[model samples]
Every structure is written in structure tokens, then in C-alpha cells.
Target: MKKDKFLFLLSKKLSNDISVEENELLTLAINTSDEYKQLADKLTKYFNQRKAKNSKTDKLRAAWTMIAKAEEENFEGTFDYAAPKSKFNIFSFLKIAAVLILALASTLVVYTLQKRSQQEIQSFNTGTTKSFKLLADGTKIWLNKNSELSYNSSFGKEKREISLQGEAYFDVVKNSAIPLFIHVGNITIEVKGTAFNVNAYSGKPYIQVALIRGLIQVSHTSDPENRILLKPNQKLIIPKALVQGNTSKFDIEPISTLDLLNETKWTSDTLIFRKEKLKDLAIRLEKKYELKIEIQSAQLKERRFSGTFTTETIKQALDGLKLSYPLTYTISNKLVIIKD
Candidate 1:
């Protein structure tokens, strides 16, 4: 059915003037049209703002009168459902009340969909192994251990957006009209077409975004006016100090081809490190192995190690770490204790 016709039916449904046959049609149409929901949401916000400012005894009645005037002027006899301009009388109040009901009904639809949108979010948490997700938009994501990603099941209809925590690699489908938006910590990454890796563990000290291909635009929550465009092979970092209200800026860095590999290698179950602090590496190891690792020696935690280990058990990986430094570890139950 045409959108205007659907709106016409919707108007009748809200005003309690719809016939039994029309009520069935309205239910089916509304249940099927996400566009109608989006439009209703916009109108709900508009009415909410106006209602907040107005001091009229009958705010909806007054608001509808103003809306009828504006909409009639804009449509100029084009809209079939346009309410006629009549004085505010008891009889006219009934007619205006119907119009007001239609508007209020739209607000109700918007509110209901918003609550449903919140409930429709698909969430996944990765455990010791990496997990994969194929979004409704055909975007593929690799969620590393201790990470999570969530998006509405209705994604890509009105908007393409997602929420992320910990770390994940996104291979987004290209759609210039509907760019993908990812919220990582206090920053948002906008992409039309890109393959990127993001590290945004809440307990970590920094949020890192590394783009392997295509372009990406990043903006921080505090400094949204300034958008930083990341070209191919570039990495962007937002320190936790900035994410937690300690600072107010982004930290951008240029990444080489090799560094890009190092950043995203974990998606393949490979732990790659180049001069990473043992303390930081321990955190990564704990996440990947799902074990509690405690560094008993503060001196050993400060030391840096560089290596890559794939297809190795946690014990084997730690034994490899023993080769680099004078460190010893013992695994009991699920905890691994490392000491000088």
C-alpha cells in the first residue's frame, strides 16, 4: 500500500473512527512497515518538544490546531487526511480531539517501538575462543575472547548501528546511503566500507581502532565536532583518561602493514606481541585462556616481551614466556601465578 494511504488508515485507527475491516488492515500494515515506525518516532519527538514548551489548557488540541494549519499550508489540498480549519468549539473539539488522538497514537507507536528496539538487541559474549557474527546487513564480525557486540535485529532499515566492548574485527558491507556506525567506549566509528579491528576493553587503559582497508571517520563523545578520518593502515587510539573524563582529545597514529597484522592477528587464534609489557600481555593471556593470571613480581610485570604463538596451550605459551625472562609460573585450579 502507498505510504500516504497507510498514514490515512493509521489516522483513522488512532481517532477510533476506523471500521472493523480498516482496523484489521491497519494492524497488518503497521506490523509490516518499519518506515511508519521511524516517521512516528520523529513526529513523537516533535510533539514532545512542543508539548513541553506549550502552556495551553489542552496542549494536544492546541498543538494539533497549529499542526493542521502548517500541514494544510504545506500540502495545500494535496493531503487527503488534512483536517479542515474550524474554530475551537465544543463540536469542533470532538473533531480536534480525533486529530489529537491520531497524533498521540503515533507517539504511542513510537514509544512502543523504541522500547521494542531496546529489547530486540542481539548480544553475544565471547569466551576463551573467538566468536563470529554475521549482522543483518551482511557485515561480518570476529569477537575476541572477553569481548561482546550488540545490535538491533532491525538494523539497516532505518540506521546501521552497533555497540561494542572489549575487542572485535568488523568487515562491513559497503552502503554509502546507510553508513555503519560503531560505538566503542566514548567514541563512534563511521564507515561506508571498511575492514577494521577495534580493542575497547572497559578495564583497559586505551581504546584502539585499526583499519586494514577502506576509510573510516572517528569521533569522540566529548569532542564530536572534530571528526578524524582514518585512511588505510591507520590506527586511532582514545586513552581511558579521555574516555573517563580525565582528558578531552583523541590520540591518532599511523600504522604500517606489519603493525596492522599484529593488531588483528588474534582473530585467527594467534597471539602476536611486539615489545608489549608483560603486565598488558598477561591481561590478554587471561582473556584468551579464560584463566586468572597474577603477576606476583612487580618487576617482571614491567618487563617487555615480543613474540607470536599460535596453536599453543596456555602452559606452553607461558613456558615460552619463561624463555624470554627469568620468570616462573605455577598453574593450580584455574589460576596461573607468575613470579620473579
Candidate 2:
């Protein structure tokens, strides 16, 4: 059906004047097309807002006046409002006109909302601490510092999907009929009731996913034919090359118990590093402490260190690193510089 016809049916549905057949048609349209679903949501929000602002009769009158004036002026030549001839019911003509006016009002509101609202739910962890969220579908997510996750308002209805910006740990509820999809850059992770940790920080050279349990499928967005199914205790690492290219050439290895613990310890506000390079470690430090870290010497940047930090100050964490290696760091203001 055309968009205008669907809108007309939607307006009738909202007004509780739609026939059973018309309601079925609208339901089918909503289920079949994402565009229709979004339109319905916008219109529903608009009607609810109107109800909150004014009485029912006043809201209806205002909507009818506004739409009738606009249509009489802009669509004057299209609709015939003349007195009906024989066999033409005047009351039916008036009822159809009212429904068309309602649809026009809904269209105006939808257009206004589209112009102003981005229509996505965004959860961003901009502070020095991690954040947690429980989705409407009973899925739990833990977002690390300086991370972001976003999904459209229509999420979890027919399919579950979200986009990730940095890092997160997800314990998804199982629903085979509606598997979850997580998009990170050019790679997509398909999960069906799995607990996994994803590290896709923008400054990093690679994106990593460690599945603690259940199953997941990872694929390059441009090359779906090149994919990998990851089993429990498996980790998939995609370098920048594979992410930007058309192939899914990446590394898939088994994750040890300790490895899983280190990967997910950040969810508990604990930072754990195992033989991590100084340069890579600086990125985590910067995010956790909201500071700027600069490694001065090339040798110092390549130095490896291992440690676990929980409830430790930035100075203390760096001091512990110095104990493991011959390094000196100077902290001034919000900046930290490291050297040999």
C-alpha cells in the first residue's frame, strides 16, 4: 500500500475508528516495513504529547482546524467537498474527509519530529568510570570508560541490534527467533544468547571479541561470504586491514580461563594487563583517568608490563609499572609523560 494510505489507516487506528480489516492491514504494514514502523512510533508519540498538553476535544479541534486549513489551501484542487449527488452518502464523505485530515496532521507531526529527533537511544560512558545498562529485552551490558552504544527506538521488536563505539561486555538473553547483532566499524558480530566481551576502541589497531559461552558468528560487513563461527572460550581478533578490506582474514584462538578473567575484569572497575605493551597500556590509562599520556622514548613504548589495578590512583598505577620496568613518568596537570 502507498504511504499516504498507510498513514490514513494509522490515523484511524489511533482514533479507534478503524475497521478490523483496516487494522490488520496497518499491522501487516508495520511488520513488513521499517519505515512504516518508525512512522507509527512518531505518530504515536505525537498523539500522546497532544493528550498531555490539552483536553481531548480541544486537541482534536486544533488538529482538525490546522489540517483543514492547510489542505483547503494547498490541496484545494485535489479533494471534492461539494454536496453529494444521489447514492452518495454525505455523512460517509464527511467521515472520509475527517480521516484524511487526521492523517495530514499526523504527517505534519512526523515530519517535524524527523527534522528534530535523531531517533536513536545512545548510552555513552564519558566519565572515568564504567556504566551498566539493562535493555528492555532483558539483555545486560557493561560499558567501559569512554565507550558508547546506540540502538534505534525500534530495537528488540522483530530483531535486536546495536552499534558499539569502544568496549562492552554483553550477557544477552537467549531468543533464537531474534538474534542480537552488534556492529563495530566494518565487522558485525551475531550473537544468540551469549556472554562476550568486545574491545573495539577507536585508537586501537584491532578489534577483539572473546566469547565466554554460547555461540557467535563474526563476519566482515563487505564480505559476508567470509565469516567465522566462534564457539565457547574462543576469541576473534580483526586487525584494521581486515576490517577495512573485503576479506575476513583474522585470528581465531582459544581463550584461557585467565584470559577471560583479564578481558572482563574491567567490567568490575578493575584494570588487568598481562604483558601488555607500554604504548597500548597508555591508552587504557588515559581513558580510565581522563588524562593525556605521552610515551617519549620508542624503547619505553615497546616495554611490556603486567598488573591489576582496582581502586588505585593514576600515580599509584604508574608507580607500580615503574616497579616492573625501568621507567619514569612525570605528571603535570591532566597530562602524563613517560620516558626511560
Writing each residue's lDDT as its tens digit, candidate 1 over 20-121 gives 656545544443334454554565465567565656525655655666676568856565665786565654575666666665666576566666665476
What 10-residue stretch in candidate 2 is worst by lDDT? 117-126
Among residues 3 or more apart in sequence or in different chains, the pairs in candidate 1 whose N, CA or C atoms overlap within 3 Å are none
lDDT of 2 by residue, 1-340 (tens): 5666887899888776788657656765664444577689878887777766667546655666656576668746655668455787554565576677777888887667655645656444546667666564657788888888887554565668899989899999898888899999888889989899999999999999999999999887777667789898889888866645445368888989998999998787656566689999999988888899999999988887665665679999888777666688899999999998
Query: TM-score of every model?
Result: 0.45, 0.46
Best by TM-score: 2
Worst 10 residues of 1 by lDDT: 27-36
Clash pairs, candidate 2, are none
Q: Give the TM-score of candidate 2.
A: 0.46
Residue 188 lDDT (model 1): 82
